[model samples]
Target: MEVETENKYLEPLFQDGSLYQNELKCDISEKISDILTTITVFGSVSIETSQPAIIYKSKKKIQAQILSAIPHHPKSIDTISISLRSKLPFPAISQSSFRGFTVSPSGFIVLSDTSQRLGIMNSCGTYDFIKKGLNSYNDITFVDDITVAASTINAIEIINLDSKLTERVISFHGICYGIRYYNGKLLCSVISKGIQMIQLSNGQITDLVKQREPENWSYLAIHDDKVYQTTSNYFVRCYTMKGEMLWEHILQQSKGVARGITVDNNGIVYIAKYNGNSIALLSPDGQRCRHLQISDTKKPWGLHFNAITNSMTVGCVNGTIELYDISYSH
Candidate 1:
């Protein structure tokens, strides 16, 4: 999406005074209202808050309220403040189109681009290592501090930092998109084969979930012994390491496809919309906590969260990288 096109779609929402005011005035259930506020303020929000309340927020209007009519608890109205913080701009990590990115434990950023190049960026955002001539690298994961694994169209390539050499680790029959290293094995999404796990030591492939008729699984992440996979059909499905299906969430207004996906240590699932120029945060149980629109001109392609710095790095299709500091609590 271009800047003009994005503005054309968002202009009505920001310029229509009546429509904006009406949306702000609509009464929302207490539970949903609390969840929205909590997620907007803090990164994670609980889904257990169930009380009756009204929610209202506007950029042009200053109106806030909290009302309760329980016998012992009287109705209370208080001023609420919400602000959008400007994110810090990071130096360009790649000149070409990058499809996936990962942060190493030592703070190096490994980025893969459509030009069949994989480069590592230092903490100062300068390229420290660059390797070329690999096939379309889709996603990358760190097998260890000195070893990295990258997924290509039909195979997995293992690259060594010390030797600076690339090796074909395994070949797949389907298109590979997202990959992650978990429990000494590799968990990846193969479009025609579903989510598959490969034993790093023996190169044996195990089909965790068989692909169904209409679902196209693309990206995946691991957190708290659970695997989260995002599909091209705008759904995020959860599974156990053993292939047990847990839950699935269909993102509303997702623009028909989903892309980048990752999970925080707190079990917050972050997913990027393919062409929507937005990202959504979901709870562990598949509840929508927040939906964030990150760009007006470019689509967010890859996401990397640095727990040590409490920050997130978002890579856009236009070769723009942004760093944002995240708050864990209000």
Candidate 2:
């Protein structure tokens, strides 16, 4: 389901001494608010407030509260597809190198090419490249608006976007292939160790799942509380946080190797079919599958979907990057 909020202004309803003046105002901007939300399976809700809640920015710490709440239903999706916007002029890397990219909530794109360069592009199409003291970056993800975490050969480096410098590094025992940030922690895919969860506050690592044998080039994406992972045997699997297999689907041999995976707001899964030269979108139930037609000739390697803005960014193995506007009918 989709909900759109229009741009408007909120003003004070009365003088400072009014009875409702002391009421808590919620200004938090994250998708997950501080107020606890409880919803049943495949459900949506809308909360209406008596007064407009103003959202403002301030350097000083601000306090707010929510004294009251409200609830909804789900819809059926008929079709899902995308349209090309424009090709992003990212510098080309080797065709055989690892390519990974991610989209921020505010519409910026962060990409990792080979082990030599990292590029950050704004909504205006201009970009900056960072290369000094760079390591072999296999994958990249946003920690927040101003920070990002990059997976290296055997470590994860926390880099500040403003300063473009490495702030901290968390070492690991095995090869780190894919990395993602959720809540306040980082979920990473390690070669033979499977998926590992790392707490950003404290350097604590927990094994969420373990692989039976060593593998190469593992990638994953998270939605709601479920984790989606791609396998080397031409399959995509869904698992719980505790490592329980929920469902698994194998793509046709014509799609080539499944490299990267991401899920949209509606729980629809997307995978980058490397040599097949296309991006595949699967239904939430893992029963229906469809391939997105790409006008480009380069093979698609990395995939990222921004649920808030309904946009997608695709990175190819030959260092080509493209953006698309996504739409779905229910």
Candidate 3:
């Protein structure tokens, strides 16, 4: 776990000048017994209105959740969302220049910023403070119910949500971009060096997943026992959860950079990127299946997917939260 060299993350991958042929056994089975769902974010405008739209998918049914943040009447310091057309309203926190939002494995939402204070909110609108130490809020990822982390200039802050404790903070050679939590494991994006595995349970750090051939990832997502990421040049690369390269897919000549990613129960990956006025759906292995574009092209910054309703939660830089439909009938 102690990454000793600049190329440390790759050490365990090659033990003795030979490929670590330690064929990592895995449950890469695609037999998902759960319901099928998908979600994509996009911007769209009607002849009468120009607003961001949210896309969703679940059980072959699609629904939309509007992301427009309207005033909650009392004018409190807490940020909350009220659907102008929604019957069920909830309180949530919002911050400025913020691009990170994460849903804990326990269903709590953490919206954070290094420029501002970090906020934790639940579906009911209750907000709490986790910690404060980042110079700039790059991204937020949940490690578990008790632990959530954020990336700043040169380090990652691990916070304990239950006790409001910052357990540990660590830095590396490059800036951190995005992170994801799965089964208590973490995958962190190191701007120029690529992804690093920060083992939460064991307290270890593996730096250069694969030496010399890293995609220099910027965003991270884990599913189907593989790690999916958006690397430099808008390419999508898939690797084993522990940093093994299973496959790589690229969108050559695509309009913009791949920014964020989400996956559905059916094993499809959804992407939000720079040149996107819509959401791009890719195969589990990184192939572009199709793109669902919004009528408007407002820049989407943060996105979360709820597979149960196929609802895609989107946060745009233009100050809006919208939902979209991404379900396809089989």
Candidate 3 lDDT over 1-330, as tens digits, reads 354462465444433433322333334324343324422323233333222232222321222233334433322111212122111112232433546777754456777653445667665555676656637667788776667787777777887777777788876666777788767656777765677777777757787374333333267777677777776646777777656787777764465556677776666776775556666667655544566555453666566666666566655555444555444532
Instruction: Evaluate model 1: give its TM-score.
Output: 0.68
TM-score of each: 0.68, 0.74, 0.63
Leading candidate by lDDT: 2
Tens-place lDDT digits, model 2, residues 30-137: 544433564223333444334324443322223222222221223223476678887866655576664677778888887777656777887776778855445678
Question: Residue 151 in model 1: shift from native, Å?
Answer: 0.6
Task: State how far residue 65 of model 3 sits from its true place (Å).
Answer: 35
lDDT score for candidate 2 against the true structure? 0.75
lDDT of 3: 0.60
Q: Rank the candidates by lDDT, best first.
A: 2, 1, 3
Q: Give candidate 2 misplaced runs (Cα > 4 Å).
A: 1-78, 92-94
State which candidate, 1 or 2, has the greater TM-score.
2
Residues 1-330, model 1: lDDT tens digits: 697686566556554432332212333454655774553432343333222243323433332222233334221111111122333223343444667878776777787777777877766656655576558788889999988999886799988877778855688777778899998899988876788899999989999888753243377888889988888557789999889999988887545357778776567777777577776777768855467665452677677666676566677676655666665522
